[model samples]
Target: MAATIGTETGAVLVNPAARNRAAAGLRSIVLPLGLALFVLVAWQTYVTVANIPSVILPSPISIAKYIVARYDILLIHAIPTTVESAVGFLLALALGVLLAILITYSEVAREALYPNLVFFQLIPKIALAPLFIIWLGIGSTSRIAFSVFIAFFPVVIATTAGFLSVDKGILRLCRSLTATEWQVFTSVRFPSALPHIFSGMKIAITLAIIGVIIGEFITAQAGLGYLIIFATARADTEVSMAAIVVLCICGLLLYGLVAVAEMIANRFYSADSR
Candidate 1:
């Protein structure tokens, strides 16, 4: 009877800890949402009180209404732009990682290519935008190329750093153990490099969006970038603001997706897992 009572008391104590953890998790989600709502309200109120002209700055309410009214139009352009960005970003990631691996394998290759990569990064991609347009025409291919150029640098540098930054001692030990080259890379270097690779990926993802938008700005028949230009030209500030808001939301969504991916990776492959 006494043991049964003790077990009940312990179970009761355990319940509150579990409940607290659940509540904390709930708060994590709710707090950010609440903060976003508060900021939106503040933005609308400020615009209203300041008597900001619709041509200069439309209120959140006005923008929201515009979004609702023109959802179909926005969807048509947004989808294609998003596809271009995604494709370009993935291409950049693949090429960057592959090059990084190759550079890691050969000191001569790294020495020869790294300087040229740096020079390429220094040359503004926009300066080449017109060239791409001429070469590829005002189409998806040109835009994707711009996106790849913008995103590729960071991924290449970050991934190369990740591979090179693997602890010397660990690498030496693997060598001493007569580990195969593949074994050394897979078992020691690759895992150690994942964080840096992910960091690069995050930067690349954001930059890829900007590149796509810039490409659209330069020459595109359709896209949010074109819509923004058109709306601004016509003084349709409501639609312009709505478009900007949608762009912001899209960027945030992409960043959030990366963050979630990182979290899942950490959960499964973290040091604790080993």
Candidate 2:
């Protein structure tokens, strides 16, 4: 009888522990979704009760309807923006990595360029969009170039910081092993600095989208930015909101791609280490 009681008590405690673990797993997915639904419901109720003008503040339902009705138009404008942003992001990544390598490998280059790089980063980048328009014209060229310009700094700074952050002892060990400069960098410095580099790349990806949007605002004849500007001019808040929602989706998709790349790279390095 005592043994049976002990087994029953253990089962009771273990069941709750398993239940609690299950609840914890569900919480991560449930909480955010619940909150978002609550906010949408509240927003819809408030707009209905207040009799708010759709032009001023469209409800979530109205925005959803607008998006569905105008999906084709939005897609047409979204493609150019996506292409320009992707191009700018890739260019910034290449230039940033190359410049960071130069700065890391050459003391003379670092001394000459690092200060200037920081200075440029400190300046208001948006103000330079017009200058790019003047140089590259009111075309996709200007938008892409401007986006690259704004996105380049974070990558360079982040990558340079990563390269410099590697342990000196590890570097010394590599050197003692008769590792060549290229081998040392590829095997030790580059791998170690990847986290920082990816950190910068994430920031650069977002900034690239912003840069392209700003360029479209200033001069583009196409793109989601143009759509937003056009809709706002007509006081079509629903359309503008729809465009913004689409833009947010694009940004998220781009950022997710970079994040996946980072995860894969990290996994590769982890496997190599083993």
Candidate 3:
């Protein structure tokens, strides 16, 4: 009877252990891939079963074929969009960080500028894209400038919050040690704010892409946004879907770059602490 009880207990424990091992092995790749496959299958089945018009909603297979056929055309349009997004994101990063530092260090600047910034942020900035075109002309410059304008706000807000979040005790200690303001900022405030700054950066990158797309929608001779508009006008839903898919890929690639940079920054800071 004791042997039977022990055997049952062992079986219960071993079963869970085996299940956990299987779950852990599958969690990262298999589960997500399986779910994505299921969704695609369902989507395909619905389109087929419903006899959906390809012009209204193309099947995933049709979109795939469209992408393959128009690969070169998509690449050509994607290049300008990628360039505009990258340039705008970089500009936003530099301007946002600089303005954040200014606002953090100067009480007068913060009082005068922060409220206005918040006000602008609350407004619909996308609505200002046409104004940017009027001011800068309908060129890549306008698109890039508009992109930078919309993407700049989140970084400033995040960075200012981070700068404010530094422990006051640390600042007092640094002052007692007769550390210069620059020294305190670099050694303490900047490092502490990195995570927040990166968080803002991630948000800004996505906004930057959105800004460029909107700009393209308003006035663009080329880009994925232009391709989407062009395809939609022709009632080529498959082509539109293909362009959208490429745009998503581009956006993901940009976001992934920021994520990689954040990971590297975190590792560097961790090593510095050690």
Candidate 4:
């Protein structure tokens, strides 16, 4: 492809930086995929040759077949978990950012709330999952609320750091230029904070899913977590593994969407992406 354009000698003028970026991206995807494929193949071969019982450790192939056989049922359980995680993540994102903004801009907020945030972040949220069920009942409300609680702090911390990270000299220049608070925020603070915000979001998304799964485990009504628990209770290893694989795929897709958003935000705010 590099030979298709630009060079007088029938070779294209290639960008070394762009080529390096492309290579890095390819490796990022391919290496993990290669490792996983190798591990699965090794696992399958060992299990088959050893005559291992499926109940003990089902082969990846068995898990895939189980998923194919029970995809409809699996999907039904997965949807609720996905929806709960998404709803909670969005709520956490909004509240976390708003609170982060407050804490960053207001000394009173920082003094009053930041310490409390740290305290909650340190607490064992898993232990509190049952408390949510007691408060909100055995429903999606409890699941979503629990997830929001789990995911909120990272966003606040990252965003506050991002907002405060800009050079003090830059802010001084903006003030000297008669920029209003809104103008400085819109033109500088938000754009500069996008990278860190996305960083926190990537982390929060995973935790949000975990929170929902914990709720599902406790509630035992629906979701892949429930399926996993139910299947494991009956010694259906294949079903449990299949449910786990589906959960992993769902999580990867959600995280990928966040990554895509980060890319879009970076491109749009190109000047401040760094």
Best by lDDT: 2
lDDT (0 to 1) per candidate? 0.87, 0.94, 0.92, 0.90
lDDT per residue, candidate 2, 100-206, as tens digits?
A: 99999999999999999989989998999999989999999999999999999999999999999999999899889999999999988999999999999999999
What TM-score does each of the candidates earn? 0.83, 0.91, 0.90, 0.88
Give the higher-TM-score candidate: 1 or 2.
Answer: 2
Model 1: per-residue Cα lDDT over 28-137, one tens digit each: 99999999999999989999999888888788888888899989998877877777888888999999999999899999999999999999999987778778789989
What ranking emerges by lDDT with the best candidate at the front?
Answer: 2, 3, 4, 1
**Candidate 3 lDDT over residue span 172-243, tens digit each:** 999999999999999999999999899999999999999999999988999988888888998988888998
User: What's the ranking of the predictions by TM-score, best on top?
Assistant: 2, 3, 4, 1
TM-score of candidate 2 against the unseen true structure: 0.91
lDDT of 3: 0.92
| Winner by lDDT between candidate 4 and candidate 1 | 4
- Please say which candidate is ahead in lDDT: 1 or 3: 3
TM-score of 4: 0.88
- What is candidate 4's local distance difference test score? 0.90
Highest-TM-score candidate: 2
Model 3: residues with Cα > 4 Å off, grouped in runs: 1-25, 28-31, 271-274
Question: Considering only N, C-alpha and C atoms within 3 Å, which residue pairs clash in candidate 1?
Answer: none
